[model samples]
Structure formats: C-alpha cells, structure tokens
Target: MNRISATRSELLARRAGIRLAIQGRDLLKEKRTALMREFDRLSADAVAAMQDLEEKARRARASLSEAVALEGPEAVGSAALAARNEIGVRLTAKSVAGVKIVDLEHDPVGRARTDRGYSLAATSPRIDTAAEGFETVVEVLLDFVAVELSLRRLAEEITRTTRRVNALEHVVVPRLEKERDFILNVLNERELENRVRLMRARSRTDERARQTGGLAERSPA
Candidate 1:
C-alpha cells in the first residue's frame, strides 16, 4: 500500500473503488455459477461417453480377434487397408465466461460396403463385421474426446474465476475499506480540533470586553 492523503478527493476515490470492485465481484460470481453448471452438464456427458467408448472398444476387439481366427490375419489387414479414408475434422470456437472452447465436427466414420474400396463378395462376412465394429468404436471415441476436451477447458476457466473472486472479496475490497475508514477518522478529528480553537478565541474576546467595560466605569464616565 502507498501513503494516502486525508482529503475529500481521496475519500471519494476510495468509495468509488469499493463500489466498482463489489460490482465486479458480483459479476464474477455469476460467471462462476454459470460455468459450474456447464461443467456439471458436460461432466455427466463425458462419463456416459466414456462408458460408451469403452463398451464399443471391447466389442470391436472381440470382433477383430474372431475375424483373425476365422478369416486369417492377412484378410483382416487387407480389408482395413482398403477401407482407409481421410477424416476431415472441423473445429469451431465457442466462448463460455470469456473462455474459448472448441466444437469438433467431422464427416461420418462408417462407410457403406459399396462406398469402401473393399467388396463384401470378396471378403468373408466375419471380416466385414469386424471392420464395422471398429468403425463404430472410432465414432464413439470422437464423441468422448470432444466432451473430455471441453471439460478440461471449462475446469481451467472455473479455477481462474474462483481466484479472481477470492482476490476481490478477501484482499482488494478490504484494503480499500480500511483506507476509507482511516481517511474518515482523520477528517473527523480535524473538524473537532477546529471547533475547539474557535470556541477558545470567542472566550478570550468576551473577557477583554468585560475588562474594558469595568475600566470605563472606574474612570468616571
């Protein structure tokens, strides 16, 4: 803290500072509340997404193993290679409480049998089933990733909002109030001292007049 003057200007400035800080704190509180709500909603979504991803992955793994055992590893590998396509992901930015989060979108993962370069006629049905199972897993994984990423960003924003609220409530506002109190006390004391000095001056003037009047009466006029 720096040395402060006991002037009306300083007092007014401190009062304004306190007012603005309180408003800011209130706004931050609102933001934190909103952010928490969003986090909670997304948290539930993330949990369900994770569960779905796990289940899909488990089924995909089993399917792949069965395919390899029945149709041979070479056939499964060739099918995977033929089905390969570039996944174009589109990311858009969205804001929550001044924090930026991304919205992820992508083209569909699973292709029709005719769309893929592979032919169902050439491959065993087991191989096709295995490929479709893995494709389904990929779809679930993308959803899980999106939810998790948003959750992470929201968590960070919540932390920052909490810190700001604490600083205002605990530190900045208190300091300003203390300074305002100091200034108010000093002004009151100065006012009291001026009043006492004025009263003393009036008493001395009254005593001098009385002495003058008594001397005139003694002088015989």
Candidate 2:
C-alpha cells in the first residue's frame, strides 16, 4: 500500500473519510438485513405458489384425460379451436425494501358456461371441467412467477449490499485509519524536534549573557 502524507490536514481528512465509510457500511448492513428478510418472505410465497400450481396442474391433466376419453381427441380439439383467447394480463411495479418487483392483474378466468365464449350444447361437461382446471393452473402459475421474480431480485440486492459493507469495513476503513495513525505519529515527532531545538537556542543565549556580565564586572574602569 502507498503511504499517506503525514500532515495535520491530511490526517483530519483521513479521519473524516473513515467516519463516512463507517456510516455507509452501517447503512449497507441495515439494507442487507432488510433485503434478506424480504427474500425469505418471498421465498415462502414462491414455495406455496409452486405447490398450488403443481396440484392444479395435476387436476388439469386428469380432467383433460377424461375429456379426451369421453369426447374423443377430435371433439376436444374442435372445442379448443372455438374458444376465444380472452385472458388479459396487466403488470404493475411495486417496491419491497427498496427492491422493485412486479405485480399482476388480469380478467377473471374460468367463468360460467355462458361467459366461457363457447356453446354449452356443443361442448361436453368433461371439456368444460378440463378448461376450468387448466385455467386455474395458469392463474396459479402466473402468481408463482411473480413471487419467484421478486425473490430473485431481492437476493441479488442483498448480495450486492453485503459485498459493499465488507469492502468498507475490511478494506477502505482500515486503510484510512492506518493513514490517520501514521500522520499523527509524524506530527508528534516534528513537534518534539522543534521543542528540543528551541530549548538549546535559549540555553546558548543565557550563557553568552552571563560571560559578558562577568567581563564587565572584572574591568577596572
């Protein structure tokens, strides 16, 4: 490491820098803690959402199999082609502990037979059951994605904050403190040297004066 200048002003500046670094480190530590908390919460949410999605998916698969068995694959394909793509997804942003995350909004899925945009007379009950089950799966999957995304962002922020805190605490702050100590020692040494020089000069002046007085007192006139 390069040596710091041993000046009083330099020492003061180093001390101030260390103080600011310490304050910044503390704030980062707090931020890391908060992000970790949010991450944990989101993680739990994601897990629950995943479990729900899995169950919904299983049910949807079973219902689809039943529909295929009852109405035959050809009828189910015809029904799927007739169905309208009416699902609307709207996303909004939210902040969690300074991290931004996404929220979702959409039209309600799995409506009544009249609202399903398909003719009830044409579609069998098994087909309707399969449609509703699949829609539930999609909804739950969307929720799961949102939760997982938020968790990922929070985890990244927490890692970044932790790195910053460690750098300040272990590297920058310690270097500044060492520089401050070095400058102080230098200043003290200079002060002691100056004091010693001044004392020696004063002693020489007193000796000269005393010798001149003795000569004057010894003279006859």
- For this target, which candidate reaches the highest TM-score against the unseen true structure? 1
Please give, for residues 3-94, the per-residue lDDT of candidate 1 as tens digits: 78999999999999999999999999999998999899989988888888889889899999999998888888888899888888888878
Taking the tens digit of each residue's C-alpha lDDT, what string does model 2 give over 101-186? Answer: 87777777767767766778988899999988987888888777777878878888888888899899999999888888888888
Top candidate, metric lDDT: 1
Worst lDDT run of 10 residues, candidate 1, spans 94-103
Q: List the residue pairs that clash in candidate 2.
A: none
Please list the residue runs of candidate 1 whose C-alpha ends up more than 4 Å from where it truly belongs after superposition. 119-122
| Cα-based lDDT for every prediction | 0.88, 0.85
Error of 2 at 194 (Å): 1.9
